[model samples]
Target: MSNLDIFVGETSGTAMLILLGGGVVAGVVLKRSKAFGAGWVAISLGWGFAVMVGAYLSAPKSAASLNPAVTLGLAIQGGIKWSDVPLYIGSEILGAMIGAFLVWVAYLGQFSAFLTDPQVLAQQPAEEGLVDQKSAPNAGPVLGVFSTGPEVRNYWQNLLTEIIATFVLVIAILTQGLNQNGDGLGPIGILITSFVVVAIGLSLGGPTGYAINPARDLGPRIVHALLPLRNKGGSDWSYAWVPVLGPLAGAALAGGFYQLAFA
Candidate 1:
């Protein structure tokens, strides 16, 4: 599935959830950059598009969920606060979910309008499959002929992956956020983050689908349940806890590590 592929079939507009969920911080960081301002930060579309384009390169055939795992880790490490955590995450969830839904409806309309066009229908199966893989990022498509995806199967393994992946993501963020770029740290910080996400998605996205965030997985999972996906039964409650629990564990570990480094 190309970057645009999984954009289809959003029963609850989950695509917005995907974009804003991840872009919220990315945008703020950009605004704080020397070249940008709070106005630039408010340019939600710009940041979203920039990050999406960067991530899209790695995921021409995927949804690029990016996972809230990254956010949870940074928050715990003191890069963000507990009080503000809810809104950012809530925005992330709502934005991505909404975007997904809109993309789905848009594609559905296109498909219905161009029913005979094989290419239009060609992307359908992939996006449909993406809705299923929302809990885990970097997990391969569930639509391929040899697609053997684990449906919330292993708790510890999934949890472990979230921890490890978040570690990689958080460490990179710490380095970038603290580093002083030419003019300021903001631009490099974002570029650093986008790069970390891309690198993680490419290198370690194979196992447990790289959920990395409780909210990213669960919020979208909720959207999946609320939405009316075809033949989309079994919301996979068994593995829901993995993303939530694993990311928090990873974030706590990051906090410990950051404190150790600073102290």
Candidate 2:
């Protein structure tokens, strides 16, 4: 496909992917949503289906590399050209940001409640002056809806977790199938790739939320930091580099390993 086609496909696919993936998190976490507390199973399945939908939609164009890690891995593995990596990653990030904004619009009422919720307000020390719940120390409870966090706070461990998970993911993608046109995954390959995401989530998601994709986490996190949401917590910028760097490292390792072991 042409460069323009690649950009459009990745953008649209990633936007939809984040929209559905982040939507599920919002539904489960936000107070007023019907899916509130629906739990981890719902999240994993939702994200899997999100991948399925996004990959299917973009399969005809840029092969639906909705994650920057995937793009990096593909480039390293020679499945994608290095020259095109920037385009794909840029499109994916933009799409994720747009998707996150759409989620805010879709859950506008819930987000309003997130800011003004009695539970959050009750915690404010009356002497502190009207607590800017919107910009509260941790930004309240909306951070998870936008990005990944660790159950454990070990930076090295968290980085390793992401690297391992993304290694598995990138390896799976590299070995999945050869795209005849050399642009993206085949249709069946896309379906398999979605399942691989689900498997990774089910097995390894507990530690650090399995941020196997850089764009998926960073893009939404950036939106989280910028959006006008009420009581949205800190975007956890301190830990953000783990997800981004770990995945890139993992992709590089996977690509190198593939070239050595299988190529």
Compute each candidate's TM-score over C-alphas: 0.58, 0.92
Q: Candidate 2 regions off by >4 Å?
A: 121-139
What tens-digit string does per-residue lDDT give for candidate 1 at 1-263? 22133233121223443444333322222212242233322333343343545344323322222345544555655554455455445545654555444433434433233334444334433321132445434332211101112434566776788788777766666555432312112544655666565566556555654555564566555655565444334456666676677776776777678778852
Top model number, lDDT: 2
lDDT assessment of candidate 1: 0.46
Residues 1-263, candidate 2: write the lDDT tens digits.
78998888999999999999999988987778899778788888899999999988887878688999999888887878889999999999999999998999999998898668877556632111122333235544677777887766788998999999999999998987668887778888888888888899889988877878899889988998999876565677877898899999999999999999988
lDDT of 1 at 169: 68
Residue 65 displacement (Å), model 1:
14
Alpha carbon lDDT of residue 117, candidate 2? 81
